[model samples]
Target chain A: MTDHRPDAGQPVTAVGEVRAGGSPDGGRLDYGGPWRRVSRKYVGVVVAESIVTGVVLAGISLFFALVIGAWFGWWMLGASVLVTVVLLVVAPRRARAIGFQLRDDDLLFRQGIMFFRIVAVPYGRMQLIDINRGPLARVLGLSDLKFVTAAASTGVSIPGLPAAEADKLRDRLVALAESRRSGL
Target chain B: MSEAGGGGAQRPVAPAAVRRAVEQLTDGKWHRLHWASPLLKGGIAFIAILAFVLANLRERLVELVIGQTGGPAGPGGGGRGGGGGGDAGRTFNGDPISAIYETGFTGVAILIVIGVLLLAVALFAVAWRMHSFRIGADAVEVRSGVVFRHNRQARLDRIQGIHITRPLFARLFGAARIELNVAGQDAKVELSYLGSRQVDELRRELLRRASGVQRAEAAAAVVAATTRSSAPLSAAGTSAGVVGAAPAATTSSPAEQSREAGILNRRVQELLGPELDLDAAPPESVVKISPLRLIGSLVVSEFTLVLLLVVAALFFSTFVLHRYFILFLLLPSVLGSLGYYVRRFSKAARYSIAATSDGVRVGFGLLSTSNDTLPPGRIHAIEVTQPILWRPMGWWMIRINRAGHASGRGGSSAPHTLLLPVGRLADVEKVLALLLPGLAGADTQGLVMEGLVARGRAASGFSRAPRRAQWLRPFSWGRTGLARTDDAVLLRTGFFWRRLTVLPLARLQSVRVSQGPVRRMLDIAELHFNTIAGPVRAELGVIDRRAAVAVFTEVSAAAVEALRADGSHRWAS
Candidate 1:
């Protein structure tokens, strides 16, 4: 088997290298450990959502075809089929792009494909760290971790982490937040 | 400080002192306001109604004059009422000229007018008597009611500010209303219809006591009393004794003794007395906004842009509708915007920001002047904005979020929050220096300018969005960046209206890094620095993913270090 070390061969950008201990080395910064992706079953969740959307679109199209004419129905069916195919192809890729990194003082969340976004929420600034489980997520044993800060604009919700991992992160964040909040 | 102490000591102890103090502090013995207060409160409404009645009578009175001049003596006609009989034969609008002889209508109208005047006078008298306020050692209580009594007390330490407002009519009478804004309280403790001079003295005294100096002295007195006497005095007794003794101690000076008598003598002629020049002693001027710039800012503002659109619509309507009726429809809105601009700009005209020993003082206004003194260490956050249009002129507006009592509503219209309405970039630096004196260092000015106008990747230690990310924000991608100093995090964004947000590390409540689907494809992120609800909201958009992570970690760590170094949270204190 090939040797596997998470930190051994990660790409380092000119901006900074991600170090574990959060110490500044020269002009470099510590961007915490390697990002941990959400559960693989999150792909199943995305596929289910896309399927439901496709079914809804098809049903609307079938109604239009039956009530109006067969030609309109055929047009809507083609459109719905095209949309479903796109979702089927794109859902897994989209799910893979979402990842989060827990640092010494803050949590860094990165997501999206074309319009990439990375959000960092400091532990000290967290007013609330909530865990939410939807019906599908509950069935799949996955949950979302939400971070609420004092600022209205800076809230973050990280979806599709395993239930166990979500709980552990919630507890860790709460403990860190408590210790750091005394200064504020 | 010595003058305050001297003035306090020489205050009279008998009629003026004991009576005024007791009336200001206790509910047992209340005092009525100046007798003219009734007329002052409701006189205008009474006069208006009376004028309406008189106007209605004008036509009938005129006809009576003409009838007496031309008609012959007739039945129901007495001395000064008789006129030529032939003239009385004429009719006005088919009504007989005898309609003017209707005494019943005239008598009833006169009686109704008199009755309305009496009711207005009585209502004012009742309102004047119902409202009374008492000043306690540590709190001011205002009690007012006719049938249902309402009482409110504001603690001296909790008092944030004292605003003296003189409406046009009040200014005519040299009367001003004192509104005491209390921290965390929605309602203000108002003392209305006080003589302008009394209002000034009362405001000064309240502010002085609120500053905690007098409270410390009172505590010392309590300690002395506790040690000297075996029997414990009641809470009210201790407070009353301290209140009476502290003023006496401060007012004992010989020079103040003469001034005390002069104040008492003037109190008798309060209404007719010269207006108390309400202006505060001007602080040393740092910057004065010129009228030309003030008007120019207003003309180029977004409000004026809307006005221009309306004018264009009006012009366009002339060709389409073939009439200028649209002008009638849009005239009010155009006039309204013009009036609003005039009022806002004219009030801000002669705006002068000054540096006081403790903080910055801002004074502005033409008709109703406002002088606001904001002590250092109380500001929550500061924002320096350069609108896209104002960018060419190199002008910036600096606004601050203060710690105590959020202004009643949103928007920059909130009084006292605006540090500079419009000023050059250099003026922004001066105001920021006064506001956050601790944050300035050798290269701060350069860093500040870079934060304001710098472009491209890594300009002045800023990590800008990569070129690949430019597709999403084509105009602003190069300009948007994040930079850090030892004490502050600067976030710059916007292409046309470039905004620079400076957040001191210690004041930061939280930091957030967020990414979306489009950003994920480009490997970019956004960094948001959360502060308490304040004017300065710091957010850097389209930062590279790696740099965003670095920013998140560094800013969080730096904030902790800054807080530790500062020891005390400025906002909390």
Candidate 2:
């Protein structure tokens, strides 16, 4: 009965009891209650990854231009710089778009701005919960939580949670999954 | 361990032969598979590797001939594979099989093959010795690998189904592969190359054991049903089943009773059975598609249309355009299509659907026959589709989704997934009854019929998409709808290819309602019923936003209730 998918352009509202790392208008995307946003530090990880990739691409183009005597090197350099700039610009919005809500019966996961997808994975059907952290994510103290279900296409993963929050959510989810363990 | 799963003391006593067979395994002693397990399982991979080695040897031999005849690096040299046309022509002469066969045991090819065979035997022998399985009260455990151990346990309560596969080569040795499918991503628990009879016996015993989880709540519900103003219909059915089960245990009617024999001398009715009753199956259960109709459907298909066009063009190029050269390139493709047509035809020749005591058996194939059992409630979803080509003939194809990868066969070109290739409306009804016993109700049957073909009936009881939603689905908007029954939900969609999907509530993993930018603008949404991966994509699109929310809540609640009441997970018990 709740308007779970409020418009992305809705004005910021008071988060009330929910505080998810200063996400703007996080309260507006509430499904009965406010959604929990991922850590904003995730933007840094994306930016850093983009910069490293850009440097590699620029170097490859430089090598071609200076060493291999290739004319397309200039075009390749332009493309890589344009891509890195676009990636840097969208990193924050992409992070903001990622949010999750833990309802009584199921955990709802949502991501993507242009082509959005919202998945509901029932607690009773959780098979396993895994926590993963890459070198960059680990440096930023962020963990990505993934849970498996009997269905191959459940595709439920929540990235960019602060380490402590990720651990707490895992514990709560494990308890919920076990207590209501309905075999597929 | 046996007591841990708790099938309750009042569990139905299995048939004596089945009980004895099960007892041998459930004693918790580890058992090794058949001696041929190594040879049969490794044969394919070994042959593949040998073929690769032999092909290389053959190429080297060809090169030697080329080097000797044409001398080193001739002026006409091309790619390494491009041996001079004359040398290559003399060797194969368009028949590769005969070229190999004619060579026989005359040369290094034979020696290399023999040596590889010996080494493979030695390695696989070790692998066979390493792999062992044990059946405990609650789980079937398998352990393999030498240095790096691989231990897998399939909980009996979580078993989806057990399937016996006899691949073409394995059948020559009267061997079968047993794969125990459970509900998880990495699901197979395989025991390869068991003797045919042993496989039958083992599969039966395994199913009975796996389906032994306790149903205390179900028993309580039955007792309550009988006592609280007894529901006459179910009470009668229960009493009748009880009466039948009683006589089954003490099988011999008093006068014919002989001295009780031990397990060693067990006789009269203890032979292992095949999955299908191909010989004496009743008329009602047997579904045989006529060859004429099969060919007719093929003629009307897109595949045949393409083939016809290719042939027509080939003829046009050869005659009208006076281009004989095109024949060389196009001739093989025509022949390949013909070969494909024959293969598809053979898949339908001996196809039969029969109901066995174990489950509904679907048997097909001409030479290396394969059939598997699907017990009641194992089916999660059923989809009946009518492609525009088959609409005139009123033919429908049925595909199903079960928990395991083994089940489902009804779509195009997937082995063991197509439940039915093509059938009439009445045939679909009969097959539906076999898969979903809950559809036996008259009301449910009516709903199914309406769902199948209710294009003009506005009052057909299905919740259709709003007229405004036609912005999305122009042609299919009138027919695309969602309906529900107590047992399952029916989602209808498609115009050019009509599809009706029925997903049981108990089988639903979760419920999701999604709205995209366009749908949000149109005040509509899409509802998806999450289920295990299979052919049936069970989702309803272009539904009104309000209805989507209402159905989402309703399904979530109903699914929870269905889970509480579902005893299908342990159907036999």
Candidate 3:
């Protein structure tokens, strides 16, 4: 696979002629790309998961067909196809919406389309920020940045970001939140 | 309302002495809740064994019945085979009565004797365990346990409030169970086992003690006030110059006199609920119901049901009603009458605003009694609630909101006192004056009230969503958006029906951020604000994740500052 990122060159169309956001001026970028155009590092993992899930399901169906009957096997195959299609359609859109902007005093997140909402996470209350990349996300070249607070364990997550971006966000948020909490 | 502590070392502290304290424990007489743990396990075990025995012997039992009845069975069948009712005997053979008697009449008699003996013993133990209570001047002690004893002690100072309830049976016995809400404790101390005479005696003693404490505190406060005035006068002369003493004394005396007059005015004002019209009692026609007529109608209406029931029963039975039947119906009627008597409208049920050392003690109770000892310095915020029905009556319930020792909903329940249950607008203002001492000086009443009204109206605009969450519309209307302003966070949305709740950053407990599949699908995040006490839970309804997080960070810092300020007060004192 070829890497599209050219550190020294001009901004290019990311993937499939889809401009996630921003003009030639790089004014205010909006909308993330389809997760297929996901970071190259995670592509292998996603393909491996897909192949493993498909093979296991197919093996189970074939065994049942031989032991029981053909009707059950066909039904199992149909159900698996329907579920796979649904997940494939939803995953990219979910990945695309997950992004965060780190500001000096607070963190900003723009999410949702219909009832559009923006959350401002201030530094003082930002207890911790953790970066994690799962198997599917790794294949997609994506990672999640989580913001934890002292009030509860269920923290906020921003998904579909590049791994390096996630790490940088975590470092900055932790420092700012710590300084604010310490009254510095 | 008043409780006296017996401080003397020689005072007898025994189980009987703690009777008053136990009565104050809860709203009902203390009966040991049957130690059901052991009994429940025993019952389950007994049922299981019985089921197992029957299941295992099912085939054998059928064969035995067939043989006994001589129903075409083999060699064991000795009785008549062709008898018409022979099959009935097969089923009846397993009956417990026959099984015991088959051994001999002695076995059956022994079973009955054992049953009666166990019942008699159980009844005695129950009575013995429940009748015990200990009372003392400072605290009431209760020791109750059947096999293993547990003791509960309640202090007078920890008594937040009292509630007296007379269930039907207790009413006939002329008994009332006193329930005391102990501060910083889950176990409510109750004194239920007292008879009418004992309850009356205990109640009298508690009231006398409470009043004595108040009187002593009042006297001390008066001396303090006199001494404080002299010291201030001297201090002003020395600090500001002797020439300025005359002006200082003149201003101080008038201010003090006006304050004293205000207290007297408020005490009188409480006699008329919040909505009193000083101009005149609304024209007689407008008053709706006259006091005399209301009283007369209530009295005449009483006991009509009982009288009618008795007459109807006599007519139906042709005066041949069983003697026991009459006695049975009389018990409930008599008990109901006693409850009605105790709960009847009385002058004593009216409101009273007693002068206290720090502020004023306003006490009231219909059946559930409450006494609020509000010190102005400790007051946090004031709220006025107008129930839709009270609009016609022109009454508003004023509440004082404060922090610290807010017991009830675990650690989260905030402390609040309902100062005016039914009072006019002016009365609400007067309460506000005492609760928020600097309100008049700052002239912020109009601004604060207007701000609250505006906020209340704006709350209706908050978004509340539809029921079904579809795959297409990942973000439900239930989500609320918040904007972080400089001083406060602006929240707008109504979940379904409209209501608004606002909290200052200083009062926020913590901030929460959450993301789910639907949130990710819609490219939205959520931020939640947790408060110590309020109707809405902070996180669930929040829609604007980014704004919420920003607000969270800011409020977290502010909350820390407020806590520090609260801590500093201890040092200042």
Candidate 4:
């Protein structure tokens, strides 16, 4: 966990040692808490979605190839299979890459494996905090949290949190947002 | 201070008197727009159609002109008289009025014309009556739409700015249109065809109410307004930056008072009316862009450079390479785009920026002029840039991000984001002082100048992108850097277009750090300071990952602190 921190052991880091807080949502939002990753079940949901997409794509290719020739069908079938395999292999790590931390003034979210992105959205600047659950994620008891600011480019989303944790996070964020609401 | 100078006789209306005058207009009852509302509303299309019909009827005018030469001698004489001999069938088969008689429909046509005129007049009268508005305490409500009614009320607190535009037709009628620029997309409430005289007072009254000025503050604001207005006007004719001469305005004697008023009136006239009807500005404007400079700058601008390259290519292929057909195809479009930009720039030919009591007033246009008053603290970000050719000329363009722009690429309408089209570096500094008063600190002012003009490796104090990042921006890596003041963060970027963006900390919504596989390998990251959407993209492309993390932390904390301290929303309070 210490290795995950950038500039580790450096005093420039305002992010202090992670510790647990004894509250409903406070534990996850604790200033001292370790950065929280989305639920592991999210990997299953992602794999399920990838399978649906892969099957649809291959189905279309198979239809075209059957109408035309087996040669075209073989090429498209091979490509679709390759894509599905890559997505299936990468789903778990991609799910693992997503994490968030609550600081003194803001909530920091980080994601991506190949292209890393981290955003710090001050509580006061938050215009909207939404919780959405996909059909597969719902069945897996996982949810996604999203934040909107005045800037459209600040499209920050934390995907695949446990359903219960998501509600806790929502309540905590809404409270913090209300107390510090400032400029739009 | 005004009282101490015995300047009360010349002092403009005081707060109580001014409020009393405003109260007459804001009586909280529905008031109809100007009498010419319907004509201004529907008359534009009507006039266009009339012009089209007259153009198609040019044959009749020619016939009348040549009719005297053995043609019809009298108004009613013509028709099968087979007049004008050979030319009879071609055009003046006689007068059009006489043709109506020959066709046996003169009485019917006359009746129809009278009937249509009556109906139009009746309709306009009703619309003028129905289209009414009410100015209440907390909100301004407008009601209209005749058969299908619409009632919209904009809250006083939400009024972002006030815009008054005088179209050529409206100006001919001595009327102006006012748009209440509310703080949302398509949220503008428009009141059109108000008497030009009424518009100034109405705009001031609305802005005053929107400012949330209380009775006490209103009095003090009047004095401050006088002081500020005098400073800019006096600064115009004297050595610049006489910003702190507020006290001097109070100590003037009766003799000096009259002289100042004369200069004030003369300066105002010069601002409003310049010798070249197209370009108007105070004589001492640091960069008074004349029509010649405007065209000259366009010739050297990047757009023209691209155009010249394409034309040269066409010439080469047509003459040397013998590809003649290609030239014919590309030449027209190249010429068309050149014409388009020329027209676009000229529509805003008469550009001027001045300090008004309500806010900074930016005016633009040629035949039809428009003015917008941007209230203080509404500007989210400021961007100053110089295209490569403009650098040596010391010409720069300034743009700012506000809550929302009511117009989309409004060509003849106001160019919404454009603060200064073209001006000298000194003009940019003066405009910045007016727009962002918090930059008054000498340290921040110095930082801004360094960001604006310092190019090449100058050893400026900004945190420069490292040498390793040269691969990312081969030519511009040396020029890109980030600096911060207590109130804002400045990110300077680009090579040919040398750009600087200032994002006030209070307006920041979020901070972001991004790194791709290549950037991660190089141990560098890009930092983004998310502000309200506008032309200025505030981002630091590649910096040390550790520095990115540190600055990200600092900005987040500082932005929150700035938000807590911000009181500019209700500036009057």
**Top candidate when judged by lDDT against the true structure:** 4
TM-score of each: 0.61, 0.70, 0.36, 0.79
Flag regions of model 3 displaced more than 4 Å: A1-184, B1-141, B146-148, B153-178, B182-186, B192-424, B430-447, B453-550, B564-573
lDDT string, candidate 4, B276-320, tens digits: 111111222223457666666667687888888898999999999
Q: Candidate 1: list runs displaced more than 4 Å.
A: A1-150, A156-184, B1-169, B175-280, B302-306, B316-332, B402-413, B438-446, B449-463, B532-536, B560-573
By how many angstroms RMSD does model 4 differ from the true structure?
9.0
Pairs of residues clashing in candidate 4: A18-A32, A19-A32
Q: Is candidate 1 or candidate 2 better by DockQ?
A: 1
Report the C-alpha displacement of residue A85, candidate 4, in angstroms: 2.0
Worst 10 residues of 2 chain B by lDDT: B261-270
Candidate 2, residues B1-573, lDDT tens digits: the string is 221112112244334433454456467887666666676677878689778868866775676576667764433322322222332323344444325534543355566768987887788778877887887766889899877889998887677666677667677666677777775544768877565545666665565555442232235442342233122123223322232333334343321211222111111122223322222212123567888887777677888888889889999999999898889998998898887767777776567775443456686766556666665467778899988989989999898887766334343223355688788997787666555552222355567777887764263868888998789998888788888787678888888899988888877877776767787677677778888788889988788766776677678767766766665555534
Question: Considering TM-score, which of the candidate structures 2 and 3 is the better prediction for this target?
Answer: 2
Query: Which fraction of the native contacts appears in each prediction?
Result: 0.39, 0.30, 0.04, 0.53
Quality of candidate 1 docking, DockQ: 0.21
Deviation from native of the Cα of residue A30 in model 4, angstroms: 18
Which candidate leads the pack in TM-score?
4
Instruction: Give the per-residue lDDT digits (tens) of candidate 1, residues B28-116.
Output: 23444434555556657858976875664466567757767886544443322322323232344443224543433545555776999
Q: Tens digits of per-residue lDDT for model 3 on B298-370?
A: 3444254665676577555545655566556565775566566344333114344422222334544444333
Arrange candidates, best DockQ first.
4, 1, 2, 3
